[model samples]
Target: MINSKFVKQKEVSISVPPGIDDGQMVRLSGMGEALEGGVPGDLYVKIHVRKHPYFRKEGFNLVTEMEVKLSEALLGADKVVATLDGEITLKVPSGTKHGMILRVKNKGVPLGGNRRGDIYIRISVQIPEKLSKEAKKLIEELKKEGL
Candidate 1:
């Protein structure tokens, strides 16, 4: 709650709505300097939302990224990802490539009126910097098989 001092020492209450974007302003009517006849001016309250650690806002949608192992990219794997709701298991398709996008429905910011946005997850495949001798042999075998 904020106290605003208008003319005649009158105070007004302003409530900011949720899901407001940064640099957006909320206007309060008749809460500014008063005119001669007791008419008041309007007051604008600017809003600022702090950055979130795990998510970013794009319009009404949310975006985040998750890392997947190289083996998971070759073969399908189930991954538990963090969303607005909570941690949920998502199916990482077999042969999924790096920088693939996965969508989680209705897991974004609130849009009001009982509506919400979606969350997009970018898959980052972790490549092993140094492959073991056995791992290199297996990769060569798979390449020979045209996989």
Candidate 2:
């Protein structure tokens, strides 16, 4: 009831009255956040609900893992774009080893209700403390093709 505006306002989302703290965002009076020309709307209650310390969600899915280094896992890494839902792309497989586990279906974590959660990238192959001479002759010719 910002002052009753005739009639033609229907946009609400209000939901942050539980002590507010997630990140904080609850400033509403008449919910005015439409803005287009007749401008007159504002209703957003995103009380800091974007938690991603290290990525860990099970509902609406979201997991985290990616440490490929050994030359991008034997030079085979291009579809590894996902800083936590950059759309969805995970296909790290050149020599991708060391616990390899890449899955980015759905992109995980929406929980709005429709349901959508999936993002797991656990690959770790990086062991080059100090090997330069052409990467130690390509790791001794890939250990004589033994890889």
- The TM-score leader among the candidates is 1
Clash totals in order: 0, 11
Give, for candidate 1, the lowest lDDT window spanning 10 residues: 4-13
TM-score of 2: 0.33
Tens-place lDDT per residue, model 1, 1-147, is 898654365566778775689999999987776756888788888888889998999988999998999999889899998877789999999989999999988778888888888999999999999999999999999999997
Reference-based lDDT, each prediction: 0.88, 0.66
Q: Write the per-residue lDDT of candidate 2 for residues 28-51, one digit (tens) a residue.
A: 754664545665565546566666
After superposition, the stretches of candidate 1 with alpha carbons farther than 4 Å from their true spots are 1-14, 35-40
How well does each candidate superpose onto the true structure, as a TM-score? 0.80, 0.33
| Candidate 2, superposed: residue stretches over 4 Å from native | 1-46, 56-65, 68-94, 97-101, 110-114, 120-127, 131-138, 143-147
